[model samples]
Target: MAEQPLLDVEQVSKSYGPRKALDGVSLQVGRGEFVALLGPNGAGKSTLFQLLSGLFVADGGSIRIGGLDLRTHMTAALARLGVVFQQPTLDLDLGVAANLRYHARLHGLGGRHARERIDAELARLGLAERAQEPARALSGGNRRKVELARALVHQPEVLLMDEATVGLDFASRRQLLDDVHALVASRGVGVLWASHLVDEAEGADRVVVLHLGHVLFTGTPAELVAHCGAADLAAAFLQLTAGGGRHAA
Candidate 1:
């Protein structure tokens, strides 16, 4: 039998008063797959991430993480998920390792097992030497790495990166992307990375394009280009979005 997808979201919807933030959205991230949720600002990317992370319940439809229904089994389903939000959440005064330890404990990890996992994740992200440094002591890019390491410390089956590379330089963004790709290759961790940058989605195993709260396309980057009959991904994105969305630099 085929194994179930690591993350499955079916026909999800959300609204703010009269404005719909998400409209019957759906996507999946399988084990070892890196799926990019590409959209410009106001395209409902963050709203979908909110649903996946349990910050907001969908107005309609269902979400399952590792096959556990998010509505009925919220705790278990959330346990299978890890996330790095666009805004920083780390305590500036907390040591790098301390922040991760706190998260690990929250997820029922502790003692030597938690330490081992934290160490492994820190080392994996090249933050081992900065373990004892206060989070405020790190640069902005390094701080993001700490958050990424913290997210993986508990070893979740699915990862959600919501505009994670926002505010990063080109090199910093590339390094972040490489680190995540390595995790996907080595640990088979499924990732749904939301971004406005077209370059970020270029290397993903699949890309789901969203615009104005609706999904516009779902396929490989090449497929998106082909489907839109454009010269390239950037052109294709502009075509699908009607050349009038807030694309970030």
Candidate 2:
């Protein structure tokens, strides 16, 4: 039997009244895989993330996380997924450790177990030495690292990073991307990282090009280049999504 993917989104569709934000979009992320959801601004990437995060339900189709159907088992499906949204959600006034503690508690994690997990994640992200500092005191990259650590504290089977590198400098972005890829390798965690930047998708195990609510392409970076007959991933992405489509609001 074929192994089930950790994250499976099949023919998922969504709309905001008259606008079809996502139409028949499908993708899968296996354990230990890093799948990049590459697209442009207003390409409905945010809509897809919203659906995956359970903030909004898809108008049609299904999303499964860790083999649990999201529609039938919302709590269980969500429990297996970790998410870092585009917007910063950390409380700047709180200490770094305090922030992670709150999230761990929200997931019903407590006591020594929670502490151990928190410590472990902090160490893994190289934030252990800065645990006592206020969140605002750290650099943008470190703050993002803290969020990544908090997301992993519960040991979710699938991680969703929505435009996670939006505000960081080039080096920070590169390092953060490297860190997530390392997580896939070390922990066998499935990742679906959404971004508009083509450069970020070059090193992914696979790239799913989504535009205008549709998945235009899915393959390795090299395959994408060959398929489009383009010189590089960036040029291929531009050509694949050249025709303008309705933008999600």
Give the Cα lDDT of each candidate.
Answer: 0.91, 0.92
| Candidate 2's TM-score | 0.96
lDDT of 1 by residue, 166-235 (tens): 9999999999999999999999999999999999999999999899988878888898888888999989
Worst 10 residues of 1 by lDDT: 240-249
lDDT of 2 at 3: 92
